[model samples]
Target: MSRKYKFRSQDDLYFISTATINWIDVFTRSLYKDIVVESLRFCQREKDLDIYAWCLMTNHLHMIIGTRGRKMEHTLRDMKQFTAKRILEALAEHPEESRHDWMLWMMERAGRRMPGNDIYQFWQHDNHPIAVFTPTVLLQKLHYIHQNPVVAGFVERPEDWLYSSAKNYYSSDLPLLDVLLIE
Candidate 1:
């Protein structure tokens, strides 16, 4: 995955997608979901990020966000690292998660196999942040993020995806981050 090698710029509205290492479905449990939400909430409160839209699938996440104070890459990096550690900790402390040992083994194997990464490599190193350079691209990413659940047959409409901002985008009542919605 050789990139063309462009430096990351400030205030880049990124539609980022990072998959779980080996595509492990680590987010199939509620505990994992809660930790992710908590991480996002904490970052939003403390990191000065503008979260536009987002979706949490079984093994990956799609987010549209930008930094207001810090660098976008730094903000995203912190969020990913924090979530990985917290999720792993929660999994280790909970004795009720059915795939505890299996999950731990997979994460450990991934950590060893992942080159130049920490011991708990839950997410791929590449953030895959596509800078939203055009209005059309931004809209397309928004639609794609919102439509992911429907495309995966999880729901009939984008608004039906509870983990996504589609509900907030459509209804405006869901407790979501302040979005940079284009008219």
Candidate 2:
């Protein structure tokens, strides 16, 4: 097993990207997307997590966040794990899932490839966290995060993406985190 790197300080904002296992398109369905939103909401409400930015792609997520307590690492871990379970369960129960067996098989193969994870892992374990130490870097990271959906061709405008915080940033009617808006 590889040594896991400890997360940075809880009080400092960090830019993070966590991908899906094998880069599978897990968030293509509303059920899976809801799992991610609920996970983020749970983190903010229960774990004292301050989510500054977020965008949910088909198979991954980018976030800018900080924690008010020392359990930010655990909060991220638990959020991903919990969402994975829920998302997997949704896939299993989905009547219209055309690629169900294929996805499950791929997840199983990935678990086998990983050294110690006994179950089929659904998320990439390594989260790339870039510490947001300056206002300039913070705005840069925010732009990068919010521009993801637009760059992916999922929406014509960033504010049109329902699963992203870009709408909030643009003063649109979307339910998103109360991000620290930067002018």
> Using TM-score as the measure, which candidate wins?
2
Please give the lDDT score at residue 74 for candidate 1. 78
Candidate 1 lDDT over residue span 37-126, tens digit each: 888888888988778889999999999887777877777789889899998888879968888888888888889987887776788777
Error of 2 at 150 (Å): 0.9
Error of 2 at 136 (Å): 0.8
46-81: candidate 2 lDDT, tens digit per residue: 888888889999999999888888477788899988
Cα TM-score per model: 0.87, 0.89
The lDDT values for all models are: 0.81, 0.83
In candidate 2, residue 168 scores what lDDT? 72
Give residue 147's lDDT in candidate 1 (0 to 100): 90
